[model samples]
Structure formats: C-alpha cells, structure tokens
Target: MGSSPDIVSPSSRIRRALWPGLWVPVVILLAGSALSFSVAKRVSSQTEALAQQHYHLQHQALVHLVLEHLYRHGNDVSLLKVPLAKAMPQHLSLRIDTLERHTKKPLLQLGSIHAPLARQALRSELDIGGHRSMVTTMPDAQLLKAPAQNLRWLVLVSGMALTLLAFVLSLYLCWRNHQQRKLVQSHRKDLKTQSQKIANLNVEKVALRQALNDSENRSRDLINLSGNLIAELDEQGQIGYISALAADIFKQAPSDLDEKPFQQLVVQVDQRRFVECLEAARADQDITQADLALAADDSEQPVPVTLRLKALTDPVRGLVGFRLSAQIKTRPHD
Candidate 1:
C-alpha cells in the first residue's frame, strides 16, 4: 500500500504540535536582567561619587575649623590639641603649618611632622593672622569601605526582587493568554454548530415552502374541476374566498360575494340550521354537514346544497375561519 502516503505530511504534523509559549517570558526575563544590571551599575556609581563628596566636605570642614582656631589664638597649639583630638576619629590624622604669606616660608608646624602620602590624604590652604597655612586631613579607608559593601548588598537584593517580579508577571501573562485562546476556540466551535443548525433549518424551510406551493396548486385544480361550489369563511361567518362555480350557484359574480355574510345567501327557512352547523364547527374544531336552500337572484325557487363545514386553522394565528365544501343537489324539475 506504500504506507498510505504517510496520511499526514511532516509539515502539517509540526504545525499541529504544541508550541511552547515561554518565549514571551524568556524575553521579559532577559530584559529585566539587563535593566537590573544597568540600574545597579548606575546606583553603584552614584553611591561612590556621594561617598567621595562626603569625604571631601569633611576634610574641608576640619581644615576650616583649624584655621579658625589659629586665627583666634595666634599659633597657640595648646588650644587646638584638645578639641582636635576630641573631634577627629581615631583613624584620621591632621597636619597644620604656618608660613609667611609673601615668602611662603614655614614659620611653625603643629601635629604630624611627616606628611602622609598623597593618595591617602586631602589637603587645603588657609590664611590665619596674616600668614598662609596648610591643613592636611587623612580619612581612614575603613570609613568608606563598610558603607560601600552595604550598598552593594542592597543593589543585589533590589536586582533579585526585580527579576522575581518580572518572572511572576510573565507567568501570569502566559496563563491569561492560554485561557483566552481556549475561550476563543470554544466560541468558534459553538458558532460552527449554530451555523450548521441554521443551514439545516434553511433547507427544511425551502422544502416546506415547495411542498406547500404544490399542495395549494393541487387543491386549486381539484376545486376548479369539481362540480360544486367551494367557499372560505372568516371567523365572523363572512365569505373570504369563493371558487369560480360560486357565480353559477349564487347567480352573481364571485367577487360580489366576498366579505358578504353567508346568511345573506341562505334561504330564510334554512338560515337557522346553517348557523347551527357553523357554530358546531367552531366549537368542536370538527367537521359539520347540513342541507340548506341557497337563494339565487335569477330564480324564484331556491337551489339545494349539501354544505360540509370544517374549522380552518393557522399555524401562527390559531383558528382563523372555516372551509365550506358545497355540493349542489338536483331538483325534480331540473
């Protein structure tokens, strides 16, 4: 059989296979990771800059205080020693030197005799009592080290939190997408079923209309061929339709009898019996038969007719009228 040509093609099989909807989540995770890294880097740089600025300001403030002391006391190292020791942390060192302003000659030195290395120290220039002085402050490396480590840990935590949030959001989106796809599929299936039912109903309607038309044509042909008068009456006992033979029986045009009460055509003596038959047909929704004399305008004598009255019903309007089939009776004279 040559394996029936593999029934389903490889391409179609691949298309029917489940596709992992994880791509959206993967992209979101990658973007979130990149954003976290950028933010951490920026924040770290800012933290470092802030720390350096704080150190520079601290150095400036200390130098300014030392100059103020020099200005008030005039080279009195004794007044500054106690306050400097109390103000400066143990890991910091300060140096001050008084020089002649014009010549820049060293006149006096206080605190550290040897200047610390430039990398570990901050220096400032000041003027006190008409002499130029230099102030050097060296802050401890440990002062910035601890806070930097804490900031790094904080950045790491924030990045992790952001990554977790992104992951959760992606999962929710995937779930919602899956649910929406299912709902759409269900609605499509329902629509397909409804469409099929509507198509079936349309087919049935076409068949019924054709059948009704055929039936009506046959009934009309039969009425035309019969040697009798056929009439349709409304609920009020008024003639609605009469066959062509009505003109011969009533001695008037068929159109003239339309909307005329049936009692008008009945002889005065037979009117009560005709009315009773109509009432019986209406009350029971059944057929009732009666013999009645129909008065014709052209003859002095009345024509005898056997009337079959049946209730007329409509699918939507219920009992609408009655159908009367009348067979003419031959008289002895005729």
Candidate 2:
C-alpha cells in the first residue's frame, strides 16, 4: 500500500505517450519543407520561361500582320481587311499609335484585355510608311494567369506534410484534443480569406467588362443615328466612306460617290473656295465651315448647304485626310 502513493495521473500518461510519437512527424515536416522549396523554385523558373515563349510566338504574329498592313496601306479605315481583332475578339487586343504629337487619339484600338500579374506587356516599335509607330499586343489573360503545370503536385505534397504534422500534434497534446481544434480553425480561416479575395476579383472583372461594352455600343449607335451625312475623305479629298444619308442628299448611291472628288459636289462658283478651305484645314488641323451650293445635277436646282471640315491627320503622314460633315441648309420661311 505504501508504493500505491506513487500512482501516475491520466494527464501525465498522455503527455509521456505524445512526446515519443512526435519525433517521426517532426523529421518528415523538415524534409518535406526543404525538398518542396527546392523543387518549387526550379519549377517556377521553367514555367515562366515556357509561358513567355508561348506568348511571344502567339502575339508576334499579330504584331507582324499589323505592321505589314500599315506598311502596305497607311493608317486608313481599310484596317478592317486585316480582320485580326474580328476573328478572336476575346483573345487579342491591338493598339496602333502613330507616335505623332499632333494627334492625341490612337490610330486604332481594337480590343480591351487586361494584362495578367507578373507578365511584361508585349510592345514593338517599327518604322512603317516612313512614320515611327508603336504596336502593343495583349494576349488573353487566361493564358497568362493559368496555374503552373506542376503546381498541383507541390500542393498535394505540402498538404500531406501539414496533415501529418497536425495529426502528430493532436496525438501529442491529448488535453481535450486542443491542438487538432486549433489546426482546423486556422485552416478554415485561411480558406475563407482566399475565397473572399477570389469573389471580389470576379465581381470587379464583370463590372469593368460590362461598362466597356455599354460605352462602345452607345458610341456606335449615336454615330449612325446622327442625321448629318458623315464621310471620310482621303488625302486627295475623295470620299472613302460616306454614310447612307449620302443617297438622299446627293441623289446617288454612296458606293457610286466613292473615289469622287469631294469638291465635285459643289457648284462651279464654290470650287476654288472648297480647295482653299481644304488647304487651310490641312494646315491648321481645325474645324472650318463654308456656305456652298451643291448641284446634284443641272436638272435640279442647286441646294445651298454648310460644309464642316476637320483635318484627319495620320501618325506618320501628316494630313492624311479630312472628316467631313455636311448639313443641309434650312431656309426660314416668312
């Protein structure tokens, strides 16, 4: 009965058992941490290099087509023939800048795509058509932000190491299973934080995409509905694209008026004045208005009208054309 005074408590027995069990897990965690870190570092470099090369080849082709188009035909509406942006509207974004200080607007901006994290924007500069312009090509962000090829394996190994570590701790601390609860709670908190961040990013992307689409649609619809006849004149002041309103005003199909000198519509008395206006607008890159008599034919009386002209400058070529808006003059009847 004297030796029974030295009996061990339940807590002491649990503690003694837990300490001996932890050595194996501790060794495993150390080895897993060191090996995983080394592998991840090597894999990250190779992944980034491969991604860069893949993206380079994909976007370089687009840039080549863009520069070639500009070389063959100076910046004009004919860019529609290239059809790069039209084919994969989501995958490619193209921006062409003449780098001309006189004009602030870009020659063409075909798409809107955000660059992914940790990737450099793809840009190239070339002398095309005797003007130095820059072409920036953006690839689909989905490709850039895709998870690395071997990332899943690394995650699985790390998760296994952590799970074993947590298990050993739970066995080591047997007081109401305190260590296990702590590990589970920490993991849940981290999971919630990551989920919240991803949800927020998705919301922002949707809002921005929707806003851009709405803005583009509004601008296109407004241009078509504005009653005034809108036409783009080439370097020679020949109509390139005249709106459908041209049919009513000129009594000729818009296609029939293509390549016709813009001043040809004016009466004989105003031909010199139109030429003068062209020169002045080209020189100043300004808005100019003139009251002119437009004769569709001698069979019909000449219709008086006001012509508005604005210089359409190209990046490399100075005054490449003019954007003309013709408004039919309305007489106030007494």
Candidate 3:
C-alpha cells in the first residue's frame, strides 16, 4: 500500500519538534536583555551618584575660595566676585550668607542670595572670620543626564546583539531538527514500501501454495513424510504454514507457528544470517543455505541447524515468497 502523503511529509513533524525547543533561546534572550537593562540602570545610578558627589565637591571648593578671599580682603565683597564667578559652573546658582556665631543672626550676605529653585541643589555651612556662614548651590542637570543617555544606548545595542545571537542559534537548531526529521521520514517511507512489497509477495504465495496443494496430493504426502521440517514464509517473513514435522521439531503446535515470523524460532544471533540467505534466494531464484541456531520450545540452548531458503514463484506473479527447510545438525558425539 502506498503511504499517505501527509504521513510521509516531514515539514509538520519538523515544526512540532522545533516548537518545544524554540522557547529556550527566547527565554535566554529575554533574561539577558533584562540583565543588561538592570546593569545599565545600576551604572546610570552610580554615575548620578558620582555626579552629585562632584557637584558637592565643587560647591565646597567655591565656598572655601570665597571664604579665603573674604578673609584676605577683610570681608570685601568686590574681591570675592571674581573668584565666585570663575569657580562656579554654568547653569548653577550659588548663595553665601554670614551669620552671628552666637545669635545666628545674619551679619552679611553676598550675591543675589536667592534664585529660581532647580530640581537638584546642595547646601552647606562653614565658619569664616569667626562668623558662621551658609553656602547653597544648584547643580547643572547635564551632569547626570549625559552619562545616563549613553548607558541607555549601550544597553540597547547589547540587547539587540543578544537577541540576534539567540535567533541564529534557534534557526540552526530548527534546521538540524528539520534535516533529522526528513531523514527519519525517508526511512519510514522506505520501510513502508518494503512492507507493501512483502504483503504483495505473501498474497501471491498464498495463491501459488493453494494451486500446488490442489494439483499434487502425492507431493504433499512426500513433504509430510520427509522427516525434515518444511515451511512456507510470506514476504513479510511470517509463517504461512508449517508441515506437521516442523511443529514437532520445534515442540510447538502447528497452530502456534502459523502467522508468526520465521525468525522467532531462530536464535537471535543467527536470525540476521538467515534473513540474508532468504534475500539471496529471492534475488537469485535458487536455493541458499546458512548455518543457523533454531530455538526449541523446551530448551534454553538453541539446536544447531542448516537453514535452506528457496524462492517460490508463479509464472504469472514472478517471485511469490520463500520456502524454508531446515535439517538439524548433529554434534560429533551424536
């Protein structure tokens, strides 16, 4: 019988095999991407922290310079102007207020002292010329923003690379699975075709055997009395019939051997050789012989036998099946 087209197709089976494995790379890619994002976020956070620290240090330094200028010039506001302008960063505002050390009362102030509030700021206090003073500074937002943006781009690029790697690996695995599935499907198709051929051969054998039995009763009687096991095997290697002597030799009822593979009665090691002999007989249309070990119903050890195979054929059907005969080989002691 011909195999159904769908059953023989490898595409669907390949897809089925690939589907379960596909998620492995997807999960890995996603996890890798998440890890990359987390690392970038951490780095951005660290950069922001360092930027804040730098801003604080700049503010402290500006406060120190202003205090030093004030002390040198005896709290001269004009002398402090140049140093403050030079030390402060752009887009930042600074304020300095001097207060009484004991009463905490403002004694002097410099700069505008107040500016538009920003999202980021720092404030600190210092003692200058026996007066406690406060310094407040607002940092430029770009200090934190630029590095964060760079980290984001880096993470994006890394995520894309990881995704691409995962995709390539997935494709490779799918392709491998497809190739393996195709090979398996091809092998199955071959086996199915061979089975169909064997079934056809069995049908022809049945017809030929029936014809032979009907045409010659003396030949049947001679086969039965020959003291050798005679058997007919179908193309699929099933026993179509076994002579009474064959059943007695295996210690099995004739009915038990019917429709069973002839190989079941042979020892496992010799079964391959026996099948090769049968195939040779089929190919050459001549008898082939092989030394085989036949299993008996009551014995653990197989009985040594010389197996013979002959192709049975009908003029109309060509090679029908195989006719197998076995002669037990006796030991030297026997």
lDDT of 3 by residue, 116-193 (tens): 337676777776567576767765555556666687668767877877787778767867777887789899999999
Instruction: Give the CA lDDT, 0 to 100, for residue 94 in model 1.
Output: 76
Error of 3 at 112 (Å): 14
Instruction: Please state the error at residue 140 of candidate 1 in Å.
Output: 6.6
TM-score of each: 0.62, 0.38, 0.45
- TM-score of model number 3: 0.45
Give the local distance difference test score of model 3: 0.75
**lDDT assessment of candidate 1:** 0.77
> Which candidate leads the pack in lDDT?
1
Which segments of candidate 2 are over 4 A away from where they belong? 1-15, 19-21, 72-77, 80-82, 86-92, 114-119, 139-141, 149-334
Q: Model 1, 240: alpha-carbon shift in Å?
A: 2.7
Q: Candidate 1 regions off by >4 Å?
A: 1-25, 56-82, 89-142, 153-182, 221-228, 251-256, 279-287, 297-302, 310-320, 331-334
Clash pairs, candidate 3, are: none
Q: Which of candidates 2 and 3 is the stronger one according to TM-score?
A: 3
Question: Candidate 1, clashing residue pairs?
Answer: none
Assess each prediction's global lDDT (C-alpha) against the native.
0.77, 0.72, 0.75
